[model samples]
Target: MTLPAPLTGVVPPVCTPLTPEGEVDVPSLLGLVDHLVTGGVDALFVLGSSSEAAHLTDSQRRLVVRTVVAHVAGRLPVLAGAIDMTTPRVLDHVAYVVEAGADAVVVTAPFYTRTHPAEIARHYRLVAGRSPVPVIAYDIPVSVHTKLSAELVLELAADGTLAGLKDSSGDLAGFRAVVTGARARAGITGFSALTGSELVVDSALALGADGAVPGLANVDPEGYVRLDRLCRAGDWDAARAEQERLCALYGMTGVGDRARMGASSSGLGAFKAALYLRGVIACPATAQPQVPLSEGEVERVGKHLAAAGLL
Candidate 1:
């Protein structure tokens, strides 16, 4: 299917469900897909940061893409995150997921190596040139240790090397620049500017972003969809109310004790815990080496769910 020009609306970066044994739980993964699809998400993004793609084995990552693609069955676009340290490693992942049926591939700037702007541009241009499906740049500076500048992103979009961008940099001003630039560029069509900011979906859309790829959407897909529709319908007040409500719900990500674990543990662990509490997934187990939330933290997640009416 042709990716929507400026792919818009809610696209949840799916959380990878794992069994107690640390293996990909296919049943739970499929169940999660059903939940998102039924919850009115516009698309599915598998193998993303939320999916623990960095921790997953190559085989497990391929399974995730293939399973999500097969289950989605063209119902919505399935974009897989082909995350790796550099271009060559990332290209291997790109080939695997694309062959497995991902509608598009999400790549990040090269990490580990001292990368130049020239190297970053060369990396994306090479990937996009070789990819069979559309290429969407995943600009998540926190993970990659490199930020995708508005100048570089707009240049790539104008050149047709990037079909879209998933901005997780949390720099709203920079995000706004890319959003405005995407619109202002004369011949750029279908270049989506998607925000990974869950707490500011309404703000991003209001600033003229094409859509949001909020990870919190997995916990509350309907909320973001409502926010998106509210923004589109020009119901700014209601959208702000809904967005603030979600921002409150997002507080659960911090409920996990910081000193006990890292942000990924606290945040993603909270999300998985919320999913398990909500009955959307059978297991809340994250990949190994990541700290698990304590029972008290799990209880806190339930309170957030109740407060949000998710329970």
Candidate 2:
């Protein structure tokens, strides 16, 4: 199916369910997809930060994209992350995901090596030139160590070098600048501005963002879906209430002890733990090198789910 111009609504970065041995749990993955689809997500994003893309091997990433694209079967647009260290490697991922049937590819600034704004621009231009599907710029300064400026984003949007932006930078002022620019700029139409923040979907949408790619939605897609609808329906009071509920639920991301693991472990572990507690996935095990949540942390996740009426 053709992706909607300015794609909107809840687009969860679907979690990559793993077995005890850390291999992709195909059945569990498919079941999770069914869960999200049934919960009314407008689209699916695979191999994203929430999916533990950094930990998966190249073949595993390909398998993830292929499986999701095949399972979704065009019911909704599927976006795949082509995250890598540099331009050439990212383009390689772009080829693989596009061949696997991703409707659009999400990319970030080149990482691990020092870069300039000019280099970032060049990188995006190169990728956009070769990619068959639409290319959405992913501004994740926390991970990539480079913030995509609103000016660069607007310039790219005006010239057709970018089709959308998925901002996880946690900088609403900057996000709003891109959103406003995308709307105000001439010769730029259907340029989607999606917030990747789980805590501020209402604010993002209220500021004219097209949609959200909240990672927490993997655990409770219906909640995010309801939030999106309430926002779109212009029920500010209800939307604020729903957003606050989800924010409280978002507390589950801190279940893991910081001394024992990194933020990725805590956040992603909490998400998978919530899924397992909710009976969405068979196992809550995260990928290797990342610390697994202890029973106590899992209990905390369960408590959060119960508080949110999810369990």
* Number of colliding residue pairs in each model: 0, 0
lDDT of 1 at 257: 80
Tell me the TM-score of each prediction against the true structure: 0.99, 0.99
Whose TM-score is greatest here?
A: 2
In the range 178-259, model 1's lDDT, one tens digit per residue, is 9898889886888899999998889899899989999899999999898999999999999999999999999999987878
Q: Which residue segments of model 1 deviate by more than 4 Å?
A: none
Cα-lDDT of candidate 2:
0.95
Compared with the true structure, all predictions reach lDDT values of 0.91, 0.95
Sequence-dependent TM-score of model 1: 0.99
Residue 271 of model 1 has an lDDT of 95
